[model samples]
Target: MIWTFVNNTFEPEEKATLQTGDLALQRGYAVFDYFRTVDHVPLFLEDYLDRFFHSAQTLFITIPHTRSQVRAIIAELIKKNNLPESGIRMIATGGYSPDSYTPVQGNLILQQQPLQLPDMARFERGIRIMTYAYQRDLPAVKSINYLMGIWLQKQLTEKGLDDVLYVQNDLISEFPRANIFIITNGGTLVTPAHNVLAGITRKKILEFAGALLPVETRDISVAELKNAAEVFMTSTTKRILPVTEIDGIRIGSGTAGPLTRQLQEQFIRLQESVTTAPYSRA
Candidate 1:
């Protein structure tokens, strides 16, 4: 039986329900963080939890459980579900509001779903993104606000593209669900420092890739990005995915370049080393 954690209780997934008056349901108010497991071990769990709590605070929704308690709950949930390879999503929603608009103490929900990583062919051949001139509100918080991204799906499908790359004020911001990076013609690695969610996978890439190339976290203009030697995106699901085309503009011989391949190889090694033991952010 599929299980989900709803308001401190583990219930059958189908039976789990949130109050209809919850701010999350009433007005789409919530924050969430997701991470994947491999062989029953969660990857970078500490980092995910830290971001989840930060998101909750940013949304003015207080999670009832302390960090340690949340961790224990996650462990128990994982054990109950018995899904060795899956994705775990933790959500904190604005509670059932008296007026249906104001924030209140939050409700916590945890779900385990099938893991859906990028296919091997996508990694080998890379992806194509259509650029959009938009900036997300509260980009730092992993909030439950994917309206624009979801709305653009029809456009993506119509354009035969893989995803949307967001740009703001002439600078590349990020993808709808991932953090973007570029290897400059000068062989430096760079990603945006502001106006984007700071993904944990992005952090790990910066940590590991710094030894091999000069790395920077600063604004990258669209022209500079389109001319980059290699372009890629990082996230829990799409680790070090190459971006071969942006708005039909070819990036580096229209293929995944040498440096992108190197970083992908490095990330593979890191992925293999992960275990169920608690991860240290430091």
Candidate 2:
């Protein structure tokens, strides 16, 4: 019973439709946020919603519904889909306009599907990351502009890479899909301060890590990243994924470092707590 919430209507996932005249199709004018459900209950939904509305504001698109309305829609979608664990994507796109360049309305689309998580083995063994020297346009907004990353997908796939970490002017920005952090030998945790989307997982990690370590928010260089004692990435889907190899350079002992594992364990506890709450729908 897979379902999709499209323009406030619930329909079969396959039957869900959008108009070609929508600016989302004609000009790629859209904003999105992703969150997951545990036991059919949304996790960190408020945080994801905050980012979604903020993105809409930045794009000057007025969401057709209030946050509470969207939240209720999500609950209904989960109930109809019957997936206890899934990933939810909330999208607000520039709606149909006679002139493609103009934004007359915004369409909200909510989709839910299986939350495909990486294998636990990858978490234990760590993953390889490819580095590209580039900066995203409007780095703070979660827009549908993934042209650069999609362009580089072939190379990334050919080498069996896990993901990409974007860098600019010798400083690290972030990954195309996640935020990055490094643990220094001196017990300091460091991640980029600006020019990146401030991810919810990244924020929670910073909050949790502050109690366990000295956290620093500043510009981080690729040189420093390659030389760090440990490196990891955070996002709604990936959680905390350690980077064992970056651009052919082995990070630390080329395995998930000690502190990274500790952080992962702590994050799991936090995630478990968030997921166990009873949902009114399920």
What does candidate 1 score in Cα RMSD to the true structure?
2.2
Q: What are the runs in model 2 whose C-alpha is more than 4 Å off?
A: 278-282
Looking at model 1, report the run of 10 residues with the lowest lDDT sum. Answer: 273-282
Summarize candidate 1's per-residue lDDT along 136-223 as a digit string, tens digits: 9999999999999999999999999999999988998988899999999999999999999999999999889988899999999999
| Cand. 1 TM to true fold | 0.96
lDDT of 2 by residue, 167-272 (tens): 9899999988899999987979999999999899998898898888899999988889999999999888889988999999998988888899889899889988
How many clashes show up per model?
0, 0
What's model 2's overall lDDT? 0.89
Candidate 1 residue runs with Cα over 4 Å from true position: 276-282
Candidate 2 lowest-lDDT run of ten: 273-282
Q: After superposition, how far is residue 72 of candidate 2 from its true place, in Å?
A: 0.5
